[model samples]
Target: PAAPANSGPLTRPQPVSLGMNAPAGPPTWFVCGAAGAGLGPADSYDVVVRIAHPESVYDLDLYGGTTDPDEAAAILAEALVGDLADPHPGSDSRRSTTVLAQLLGPFKAVHGRFPSVPELRQLLDGAAGPLAALRKALTATGHESLLRELDARERQMGHPGDVGAVLADRIALLDRPAFAGFFDTSGQSRPFSLKALDHPVRVRIDLPERGHADASRILARLVLAQFTASVTVRDDRSLFACLLLDDATGVVTPEAVRAVQRLRSANAGVALTLRTLDDVPRPLRGPLLGATGCRMAFSGLTPWDGQDFAEVWGKEWTEARDVTDRQIIAETPAGKAFTVVRRVITGKAPTARAVTVRQVERERWSASELAHGVPAGHAVLSLTTVKGEHAPPLLVDLRGGPRV
Candidate 1:
């Protein structure tokens, strides 16, 4: 089955459900959001998710898709089922061996760099030696579950000397053309500082969870570490670096939380966008936000989250009135004499000062107000300056803000 021909302003080569029971033709959909100041939903499943910025570099971590294990395995298998980085495995190149060696952290740690598999093989007595090391490497990396799965795949495809090669092949997808520039690099070392460049370069990595979030999570950390480290060395005002993570869930490491603090002085920042506070892992939330100066929230925060934001935002006082019923009745000039008697009977008379009130304390934006008072197309932004100056939460029209 093919998608209906109506892809109005949509990116092409999108995937449609072409299964047996699927519609003979794919759906024709109307765009829910119009172009201009807003964004629209991408109806189809598969997409490249490009980020192109002229004269500037970007590290984009895109994470979204089905979270099923079976599908994850299948998708990973599909991506990895080719000749990995070493196209010529028989030519005795150091590439595949190096990949396998680094893929196993403990081995790389002990050996300095992974020896060529044949070099490792020459030092070992049995075919099972590398497999034992592989098992130990998996354990050291806290990926023990993968060892069992690796053994099962080995039982299917590997012979006596193929264990290390098979394991390396499982992740060989990274070396493929789809991921060529990103994960499998020739390790170019250069004086590539954004501050030094008269022009900027933009590199966008689209890690859509076509199933297998493990890879995306790994890639996110790698990109974040590189981006943060690159910023550490330079702080040119013109060299602004941003690491953008979309749907950042478990991928946010403690280092990333600290990087938020460290990158600030380097004119760099990390922006993580998740669905809600719940999407943020509890342990890192405090450190993450505590280190960051600015925070912005759209309409979806729950009551508990609103309370947290409200508490941090603190309170402000506004004028309030305490009204006591004491109305002055106008007396005619002829009846002015009875005013003293009326005052005597009433015990008090109305005075010229008819009303008096005092200012009272209240939370600037109450929890409920934050949860509900915010209208569509507006956000509450709390900004703090490097000089430690702070501003209260402001409800701002998103469209009115200057373009980034």
Candidate 2:
């Protein structure tokens, strides 16, 4: 059946706790790489994963390598199982283990199959017997009812598939309550269903290149998943933030930008940086550039790149002013000399705005002649002092500066 409008966006079953939970804020950064280590060491920032909303925020450290989907799935399963183990020590490890095995099992059994939450739940439910036995063993050791709640959850949720569905549904529900409730005409909303909330301010993705296509797919999926999570819980007043930084070229695919467009439509902010502008594929350039509000140019050396930058900044601005190559003509008593100057001279020459370039020189008497110097901020002064051996510094009073 065609899904209803309120059915919300279709999503792959994501680990409930693989996301972040915080009030939404401006999207400041988006970083993409093979591992979280690429962003920096773990000590750099606080890391948290939302078990209930895997799409929201995740620890990139867990999925670092570029492995096949099956291998990746297996890795994710192991990571999740490991996390659950500490909280439910007495729970049946077999079920959790089996659930992953089935999803990532060998010989095409696990191939082409991305288990939804419901599928995972069913498998886990089947392993309940083993879990129950383990629980009983723990109870005897003085941890009674250690897994009773989990067992009860299994029963209340019914089939393993249903449990998975509920978890997925709840995660989604949390991001889109109104839309989620629209489909439930019974006048009573499901208690644990997903609800829409404000989009998160930041998201981090791990993209490892096991295969070109597969890695691209993973990046694409991460982008879509984040956008889906954002829209389902966006607030009107908030600007969603997406920061994508990739160390590897071609790690982000066209699908990634398309997914970002979805977020942009929801009024989200996005910033994506690659090794170079050329790293952005030609096909995806338009939308990617359109989504960005600002562009920053660092030290670019390539001739083609220099031309590309000129094209991007437009010839009108570059030609309308006499600042090409930052050259300036200074009239000296000896003759007219052309000097290469470092200044940002804007507008047309005679009637244009002029500013002086700040320069730092070593203090001759300082240190064992080992005193070093560095260039600093900008300053503006009269050009008549250009050839003067000694020039007085000009100071403007900010209290009475010209008002625009």
Candidate 3:
């Protein structure tokens, strides 16, 4: 049966009959939106989790208090490495990856807890006194490779401490006075892990982007990375998982692009919102666009951004009609008289008209039309199903209500 035509936003809850009906219930909506966005009324949700930022001063665990060392390290590395440049041989990225990978696990095992941002900053500084004790511990454990990575850092620690100093500088930002009590490692603030996605539970993390823009971006990327990782290893593949990032600026990286590609196979999807293609890195712009099954360009999209969508949507075949009017020569006198009479009667030229039709290929939506032709409260969208079915670009009026 169809629902009531004038149903209000508030509706009656599902009734539970005595062992007769089993409602599947609502699925969890894990939202990651900007801080101060006031996503919704607190009473509407079962749980409301807030993050620690400058304005909203609270202690939120950065590491998520995971017992697994590898998971902890991955999250930490995602925060430090902004774009995650290719780790070529002898490159800063490679050295940085090596140092971080070797340091995180051992430090966790030895200290029985993850290191805080300030402690991590000190550990990466080659000149720091703690490195000596860490070295002795690594030596005793026969971690020759880890020791070698540290030695390499020392070698590269010329006037500027190559990768270590670069990474340490990044860690130092969080350690500043403004971020005190945040990113805590003392296990005081209950860490929220993406692993919670395994069950049906609602979670929302509000990022503080106003004053702490860089930290917000770092946290956004970290959450995205963790979400992808969690979805990949879900116990039940039948349950569909989804993540929506309200603002995805500076969150798209090489790893993230790859992760987006694998999401569909895992019965999962991610929706990212960006102001423009410029928000994505130059090289990853194409890959990220390709990875997403659904692409939407709202009104005010620049031609440059529209061009990418136009290319992705490609071209379609359509019929083209051509019409031509030829003046009659009037070879016979009777025909000339009839033509003149008809022309006089109609008050126009007497001519024969010809029509031709042919198949032609054209863009679904041209760049100019997408950029300027899209009206306010409208967007161009294209979609591809997990089974490889496709829907070409469509101009949709967002102001319209959902169709029944």
- Output the number of the TM-score-best candidate: 3
Which residue pairs show collisions in model 1? 55-200, 56-200, 56-201, 56-202, 57-201, 57-202
Clashing pairs in 3: none
Top lDDT hit: 3
lDDT of 3 by residue, 1-404 (tens): 00111111111121112012322333434567676655555455445555654444234456644677666666666656756556522234444566676667667656777778877888777655777887788888887776776676556665543566667766776776766656777767645677766556656677777777877788788778778877888887665666667778788887789889999898777777776788887788888888988887777878887788888788999999999999887989999999899999998778899999999999999889888998866778787977899988787775664421
The per-prediction CA RMSD against the true structure, in angstroms, equals 16.0, 21.4, 6.5
Q: 205-250 in candidate 1: lDDT tens per residue? A: 4453454454455444544554554466553434444544544544
Instruction: Score candidate 1 by lDDT.
Output: 0.45
What C-alpha lDDT, on a 0 to 100 scale, does residue 367 get in candidate 1?
80
Give the Cα-based TM-score of candidate 1 against the true structure: 0.50
Of 1 and 3, which scores higher on TM-score?
3
Off by over 4 Å in 2: 1-30, 36-38, 41-217, 232-239, 251-255, 258-265, 317-404
- How far residue 68's Cα lies from its native spot in candidate 1, in Å, is 36
Cα-based TM-score, every candidate: 0.50, 0.34, 0.82
Model 1 worst lDDT window (10 residues): 28-37
